[model samples]
Target chain A: MSIIKAVHLRKRFIVKKKEPGLKGALKGIFAPKKIIINALDDVSFSMKKGEIIGLIGPNGAGKSTTIKILTGILQPLSGEVEVMGLNPQKKRAEVVSRIGVVFGQRSQLYWDIRLGESFELFRRIYRIPDEEYNANLELMDSLLGIRRLIDIPVRQLSLGQRMRGEIVSAVLHSPDILFLDEPTIGLDIQAKRNIRKFIREINQKKKTTIILTTHDLGDVQELCPRLVVINKGKIIEDGALDAIVHRLAPERILQIDTDKVKKDFTYPHCKMIKCEENKMWISFNRENVSASKLIAALSAEVRINDLQVKEPDIEDAIEQIYGEG
Target chain B: MRCAVQSWFEYPLEMLCWIIFIPLYSFGGLLLLKVISTQFSEIGGWTFHGLAFFYGLGIVTHGLHVIFFFAVWHTNYMVLNGEFDRILLYPMNPFFMFIIQSFNIAGYIDITPGIIIFTYACLKLNLDWNAVAILKLIAVLIGGTLIRTGIFMIAGAIGFFRDTRNAVTNFMVDFLAYNTTAFPLNIYPYGIQVILTFLIPVGFINTYPAQDFMGMDNTFSIPINLSLCTLLVGIAFFLLAYGFFRFGLKHYKSTGS
Candidate 1:
């Protein structure tokens, strides 16, 4: 089922422009220039239940704005958004109650209080029943090993621990949909692995639908099967991760280290992009030339010492989209 | 509210300092009133005890306002920092959540000296303490707090449209609330008195209610029970301010992260 839908979402902000120097400051006090920023323009997408979709984009590409609109923290100038068959803007309280959100740059937990205390406060705010709250807390503790960090003040906890606490706080009420905005923006590898495991566990155990917006391609590669690539306030590409990679970045790099230089060496279905001394870099479409075939051709021309095949990743695919945009 | 109090208590030294300093601050104000009383037997037709009563009443209302509605003062900061976005994301009523999240236990320190001064003034005046009178005092405190909070809320709501950085709220608290409500309104010219009573309504917070308590005749020519008007005006003004705040919410352009 389509659990979330947005149609032609448009949002704009009026920003004040102040010129440089003292005279400009004085003039700004009198009459400042105003500029309009179209934060989101004609952005539309839909998500099905129990699916993990990555919303990836460059900085200031309206990723956060789209998440805010979906969560009803923002109102679009023109659009229709429906979450769980209800208009999010009109039924904000109801919609918010059914959805959980985590903004990695911002925190919902009280900084001066214990992590457990903050969770208790959220429990009261979300009105979660004591039984369900306890159950969820236990599940989170088991999955993330958060029991040790619960007594520490949020300000005192390490970023990774605090982020685990944040995720637990968000899901204490058992929301059906979860929005994670840059959830792994700053974390060590172990911490990031723990969070990803927890997220996968939650989705598998509860079938929670998740919308993840992030710049971390590793996060997208591991967690999201579907991807929505946005740039300059527009949805440029949306499909399965494999499909996007195939369409945008189908070329693989072949690095070959040869014993001797071959000035006139050439091959079909591949181009040598770089050559220096006895080393060469070849670019080839994966569909047109297999790594073995290219290796065979290079060996026939020159004695090969070492060779390596580099596959294109999600980063390359997203860069391809951003470059076109 | 529990979390707010818990966090406040976490700072032992700061909490101790605030506890000690609040009563000392109230005592300093009382000393000023004492000096003024010694200089003039009656200023603006009110004796030293009547003035003490008025001052104590104002302090109590101020304490309550600080305790319950102090978060309104930070609306500008919250809007600028995008912290207001989290408040909106909550399922609860954002205004109620904002107020509750900032429930300050330090305000109880302010109330301690206020109650002592109010009790001292009552004893000096030989005022009859009845159930109705006690209820009236509670009602007056609530009304006065609502008035103070409503005015500040209006000022705070302006943050949604412009980045005032709380200049307007500071002005209102300093000039309208402190300068006027802390003294007998009758000391001002008749025009200023009318403005305080009807236009800005700071007079209704303390001066008008104190007039009713002291059984003094209404200074203004307007035909209205000034005491009864306090609660009504407070409710009406608070509702209007909340409506304005809601209007601002509709136009809230949340700051970028």
Candidate 2:
């Protein structure tokens, strides 16, 4: 069953435009130019329960706008958004109660209080039963090891610790759906690994539906089986992660080390991209020329000592998607 | 509320400054009342004690306004900085969240001097302190707070439309609330009195309520009882202002990330 759906969502913003220099500043006081920005234009997507979907896009591609609209923090100019069979805008309180949100650059925790106290406040705000709240906290502590950091003030916690606390705070009520915007923005490798593991465990243990937006392809590559690519306020591609990667970036680079130098090496269906000294880099589509076949052909022309085939990653696919736009 | 109190205690030096400065500020108003009393028996048919009562009422209501509605002052900054986005994400009314999140405990210091002056004035006036009168006083204080808060809310809601950076709020607080409401409305010209009483309704905060205690006739020909008018006006104005706030929320354009 579809747990969340958005149809033809459109949102725009009117911003004041100012010219350069002091004279323009003075003129702006009386007659400032206004420009309209279509932040989201005809964007649509859907998600089923317990599915981890990655919403990836370039900057200003309306990734955050779409999340805000789903969370009911923003009202789209025109759209139909239904979360758990209810309109998020019309039934905001009910919709918000069933879902959780975390903006990587923004914190929902009180800065002056201990992390535990912030959780306590969230309990009251959501009106979570004491038993359920305690159970959730214990689960979070077991999974993320958040018990020791609870006593520390939120402002004093390092970014990774604070992010963990933020995730705990978001899930204290056991929301059915979680929307994460850039969750692993600035964490170290170990912290990112821990967070990714925690997210996986939560999804498995609670069957929580997750929709994450991020620039980190590692997050998408590891956590999301499905990928939705957006650029310029529109959906560009949406499908299985590997399927989209293959469709957009199918070519692989084959690097060869040879003892003897060949003045000219030519092969059908393959192009030599780079060569220096005893090494040569060749590019060919996997569908057009198999790596083994190309290597077999290359060994006959030159004394190839070693070779490595580099597969195309999501980063390259994403770059290609953005470059096309 | 606990968090706000804890944060307050964390800034000991700042708390000490507020403790000392708030009462001194109220004292300055009292000194002005003293000067007016010496020069003339009454500014607008109000005796020294009666004027003191009115001034004390204004101070108390002002302090309460600061205590309860202090968050309104930061609405512009919140909207501009994307802090309001976080408040909207909570599973509660955004307005309610905004109020409780910034509950200011230090405003208690502001209330202290006002209470002291009010009690002193009550003793001097020797007014009847019956249950009904006490209830009326409570009603007046509550009504006055609602009036101030309503006006401030209107000012703050304008932030949703444009970035005023508290400019409109400052004008409302300094000129309309403190300077205008502190004195007898009758002292102003008739046109000003009408504007204050009915249009902006700052006069209802203290002037109309005090008139009943001072045995003065209703300056305006309004049919409602003078004693109950403040509460009625307060409720009506607050509802209207809140509706305006809701309208602004519909048009709220959160800052871009």
Q: Highest DockQ: which candidate?
A: 2
Each model's backbone clash number? 0, 0
Residue-wise lDDT of candidate 1 within A1-325, one digit each (tens)? 6999999999998988999999999998899899999989999999999999999999999999999999988889998999999987889889999999999999999999899999888888899999999999999989998899988999999999889988998899999999999989889999999989988999999999999998889888999999998988999989999999988999999888887867667778788888899898889998878888778877888898988888888788888898888
> How much lDDT does candidate 1 score?
0.88
Go through the candidates in order and give each one's C-alpha lDDT: 0.88, 0.88
Mind giving the per-residue lDDT tens digits that candidate 1 earns over B88-176?
87898889988998998888988888888888999999988799787788778888999988888888888888977877667765578
Candidate 1 residue-wise lDDT at A39: 89
Q: Which ten residues in a row have the lowest lDDT in candidate 2 chain B?
A: B165-174
Q: Score the docking of each candidate (DockQ).
A: 0.72, 0.77
List model 2 lDDT by residue over B10-125, tens digit each: 77999999999989999888888889888986677888888888888888998898898888778777877878778888889989898888898877898889888888889999
Worst 10 residues of 2 chain A by lDDT: A260-269
Which regions of candidate 1 deviate over 4 angstroms?
A287-297
Native contacts, share recovered per candidate: 0.63, 0.65
Residue A169 in model 1: lDDT: 88
